[model samples]
Target: MPQIPPPQQQVTHVNPQTLEELPAPVMQQIQPITPGQVRSARSAMEDMSAAAKTSPLTPIPRISSQTVSLSAGASIPQVRVFPNQATTVTFSDATGHPWVLGAPPYNSSPCATGGELCVGYIPGSAVFTIQPTNAYASGNITVLLKGLATPVIINVKGAEPSVKSKTVDVDYRLDLRIPKRSPDTPVYTATPEKKISLYDKQLQSVLDGIPPEDAQRLKLKNAPGSTKVWQIGDELYVRSNMQLQDEFEKTLSAIDGTHVYVLPATPVLTFSVNGQARDVEVELN
Candidate 1:
């Protein structure tokens, strides 16, 4: 009875299986990686930083030549200022040559190669900047031309230190011009001629022309024979051609001090006192 019940429920239904099989999934293509890209970028950044550190330095320079020409009157010529460091400096000049600015050693401080020249500039202050390139004493400096012979005055404002520090500002400039030669030039000088003019009548007449005030101004002394004493001044004493400003000075070793005062203004003598040699305050009797 159990087997008959199972055979009665054996009905099977099969549907159409018409679905297409899907293609195998393909893997995504990956890009090839280049080597050292990160390292190159790091190296580039390092170079940029290094460039930023070294480019703005300026050092002081020495003056190679200096000249003053009287032909140009008071006008200053173009003077070149060089820096002692390896940095670049900007300067200016618009006038003639006499105003050409040059820098010298600052005070007691010596100017060394690859170092600062001095300090302080009034005209162009904002153009100054310090950098590592100025660590040395030689560098290219630019002087900008603003106006002419307006007296480009530059001074060293900072003190030079024995030890290097970033605090000091080194600057120096020159005010120069050709010195004019005076019109009254000494043309002829008397040479050492062994001729004595003491007894000459013409020389005595010439000597008589000298005022008593002039003779007193010279502190001329009268003495017997050739030996004479000329009391010149408290500090200065002259014997013959020798002049002495100090009592202990050995320059007048040949002159013996007799302290004799002379009358009349005579240029003839073996030795004579020159200049305002006496401080006599005499009252009239």
Candidate 2:
């Protein structure tokens, strides 16, 4: 014998003052949904929910333009360093050339260090490159720039073991500045901006080995094979094959199977392979 169904519950909005259910409002329009549409939405959501724990675990660096300015009389700030990655410090004159020389090309002191932080640069140029030789390297370095009133001190340290966002501990690029350029410094013409295709400006930048200034690097914990990801504004730039089922706005086809696709930005990105959803794996490029 068939079982009887339970009574259904009716939900209605009520007015606080009257404590009575308000009259049901008439529907303006009836939006239609086919059975297939409902199933597709539910399947998509389930795929994402299946691997929440395997999503990106590290905060990826977005391609950024603003430099961390080092000013005089400011407290020494620690710069994150990583083994095998070089952190570069550069001081360019108003002309954009290394400002290590004076009106007559003279400098007072070279880079001085006393730690496992290996520091090196051109003898007279105002660019210093540093690499941490030890995994737990912790030390400081002082530099006396030419014509500067005071020396610059940099505190270096190892990656913290307890930080979730520690993937960004990879080497950082540094830009140094002086209070003012000397009076006798001559003005030089600024270099023209490198021309990039208007259609593929952002993707082209990555291929050129320099991402656009405003692009942010997103760290992907499980990027698809050989795929890289970046975020520019609301768009997610992907360097991978075009075997994608989801809709994408733009793409750059490459002779190699790997290509760049502009996809919708989401907290987590998943790639569909053989009807199965897989999370993308990535690292700092």
Candidate 3:
């Protein structure tokens, strides 16, 4: 009985390679991922990543996409003010809204030098006054409006209260008059030629009578090509093409007591407006 002990139970072992070759179980269905879900998941992941990177003590930088610019308008009219005199400047916004005075800060060059130019603004009114110290205190007063690219320029001129006065003597003997030509003088005839020759001789005589000093004072020599002597009514006009210097009037006044005739000429003052040279007529009193 011992020798015939029960047959041992048979045992079998499968190789790992054989189990790996076996087919996987088939799944019945699966949920399809939509594009919206993918996007949401990706956004959530990005937000989480950003939150992790940022600290509570750190400040996030902000960026702006729009640009701002100042308003541009027509050039303001040139302001002319006599020294020690005051004038107001009023301006409106691009939308026609008047600017509040003193709201936009203003600055002036050579500021508050006691005798220098002074600029003051009146609150609640869109006006600013500019004043100089005296007639002799003359210079450019530039008023800059904050946030404005262009400045309001005021030309301060020294207008003296007193003007030199002198008597001007005229010689009626040198009066240029057009003689009445005889109607009997026929055109294209010897009579007309003789009349023209006589007129030329008379003109030469009148010219010769003008003294050399008088000619020099009148600036007749080296005068421009456009210079002309015109006789209008009882007055004589000597027009010179070039601008006369300031001393020209003084010279004429010095020659007042003489036989030479003097005709009043318009006086011009040359100045700069925003770096551009300009001429303005000045009345002499």
Candidate 4:
């Protein structure tokens, strides 16, 4: 009866100093994203991550090495280095062996002050990284390795690189063969132990299309042969499809049709073609 007596108008008191409870704010009408939209956003994020991971290098690293020989002597080879950049020199011959980089035999001007070039080497390996701070920096580095009568001397020089300057100068991964010594040649030097197996484990890297650091990849030009030649030291070796003569000893014949044979750096090789001996002249392309 009291409630029915009056539908009283509600009165609210407002206070400026004291806080008052207010009705909860209505949550924004949040539009929930559907599974497809969520998937699309996830896919976009994944694509971005993939792209970032597989981005191409600004300047692709290239192998531009040539073949050269190493002999026992005081002969020093020159390596070209870039200013403010590092160039690596690998003794492809002693890739897995231990070698010591002795104090550089000699250094000049800026190099003497240790400002022109900074030199370092990988542990227990004959790999050197030369960093040049001056554009015209130059110096000599001496290295001693087992099986050598004399130490290896490298001349590091600063150079300006061209588009085609990434050759052996930049890396110096050349075919370093000890100039063939005759029986009469009297040289007191330690030599690598004679290998008993024809299938040298060192060749596994070469068979996989990545030349072993010791293998000297021969650059061919206009050679008339399906065989590719790699010179490791003074010995000539090949991975070829040619049916070699019975006399051609092979270390491996992969199921992939690659037959590896080694020759004594000869100019001609005997191949069995059509069941006939075809004397193919081994020429470089």
Candidate 5:
């Protein structure tokens, strides 16, 4: 109560050395980034990511439309190789830039027939060689390129010499009669003229020459005379008569219809035989 009578002032004491030595707090300056600068930095990062995701270059090969044909029991057919024999495929990128290709494996199909046909390609080569095991039968040889969907089809033909024959009876009327009053008698006799020989190769050639559309309308028939004919709808007939004159006429008519065309006697494809060299034009799909 005695101290409350007057307001008392309190004095605080500070050390002079501590106050004098204490340093003032320093303010640090921080630079703020603008919206434009932030946008530019993000764009640069996106560009770098796109470059990292780019794919390597790849090349494609070229092939020809005409197929190669091989004969049964024949030596291996030599194929004309692509230029440089590099076996490197060439392809253009989305940027229209061309690139060379690395080596790839090949695949081949077995002969459709029971026989085996040797088929293969050399490393870095587009040309495929063919060799047949036997002359048993004919079939198609298929070759596949790795990474490609389409296949190369090579035809193999068997040229074995075979003749199929048939015989029929022919009747010729004789003028001689036994008695003056005896009724006329009819006699039937078989003749060599009725026999026909069918050549296998000739028949195959005719069938192969027929157009797909016309072939669907034709059917082979076995007649009494051993003669074969392409019968069309009962009304139309394309006969293979043994007579030379008739045969010539029939062949001409068949070719004129645009349904049949004669193939080479040796049945060769575009390439030459006997190790002849030829330039191959190939276009890849």
Candidate 6:
């Protein structure tokens, strides 16, 4: 049989600096830390410090303008952020593709109020470049300038709370003016009257039966002859001339409802048209 050696006994050392000194074996068992972990810990501290100083949210101003150009047709505008202010602006498209637009990039930096949030529209990429560090101010740029084709939601946060959002529609026509510098002013000019064909009495009777409420909404009372006419919400109540009643009845037969109420507009004397003064039957519509 092989013989086994007995374990050695441990001893403690006392020192002037401390009450106890650990055994040599105990001290040797402790492993040294790697440099990589130390570097990672330092980096984490730096990141936390940066986050503490930067704000997580921003705001945008409520802007109103009449000169919006809807030609872009659903693209977000480019935005420039001014100095000393910050805001958060968001954009969404019909495709469920969403992107953020503001002074600073969503997680980049902060914006300065009274500063510029310059938004330029690019139809292709639908991207906005926010310059939070830009030196421009609000008054220097036009907030209502039509840049994008689509609507955008803007949240302006800083000195004041403001929110604005709008979906723009495209204007199919070009805007032309006879050389005027001021957009704030209105331009008007009067021209000679033009002749137009008039509606006949039979047509007028049909027109007259129209209820004021319905006529006003359809704008049919004073429209031109060729305009394609269509009825609105409910079926109309109609009163017709006697001679036209039979013809009108056939027309009403196609329209489903008890809406047509026929009455004569004038009295018919039996003897007047024939040669005798017989009993007269008057038809009023």
Highest lDDT: give the candidate number. Answer: 2
For each candidate in the order shown, give its overall lDDT on alpha carbons: 0.30, 0.54, 0.37, 0.52, 0.29, 0.29
Query: Where is the poorest 10-residue window by lDDT in model 3?
Result: 251-260
lDDT, candidate 5, at 23: 37
For candidate 2, report its TM-score. 0.36
Cα RMSD to the true fold for all candidates: 26.8, 26.1, 32.1, 15.1, 28.9, 21.6
Off by over 4 Å in 4: 1-75, 92-112, 147-149, 160-169, 172-285
The sequence of per-residue lDDT tens digits that candidate 4 reaches over residues 197-217 is 223544544544566777766
What's the true lDDT of residue 101 in model 1? 28
TM-score for all models, in order of appearance: 0.20, 0.36, 0.25, 0.37, 0.19, 0.20
Which ranges of candidate 3 are over 4 A from the true structure? 1-77, 93-97, 101-111, 144-147, 159-285
What is the C-alpha lDDT profile of model 5 across 1-285, one tens digit per residue? Answer: 565566678888887766753233321223256679889989999999988654222212222111122234533221222211122112221111121122332323243444454444455433444444443334554444333333334344432232332221111110110101111112331112122111223432443343223322333322222222332222222233222211111222111111111221111112222344222221111
Better candidate number, 1 or 4, judged by TM-score: 4
Ranked candidates (lDDT, high to low): 2, 4, 3, 1, 6, 5
lDDT of 2 at 4: 89
What residue pairs clash in candidate 3, if any at all? none
Q: Model 2, 1-285: lDDT tens per residue?
A: 999899889888776887664443422233256579889999998988887534233323221111123555657745566666677666543322345732121112222334576776677666677677655777776666677655566677755543645344344665543434433346432222121122355664564346688777878886666666777777877766535445566654322334456767865666766668886544433
Tens digits of per-residue lDDT, candidate 1, 198-265, equal 22332222222322221223334452323322222232222233222222222211112212222322
lDDT of 3: 0.37
Model 5: how far residue 194 lies from native, Å: 56
- Model 1: how large is the Cα RMSD against the reference? 26.8
Evaluation by TM-score, superior candidate among 2 and 3: 2
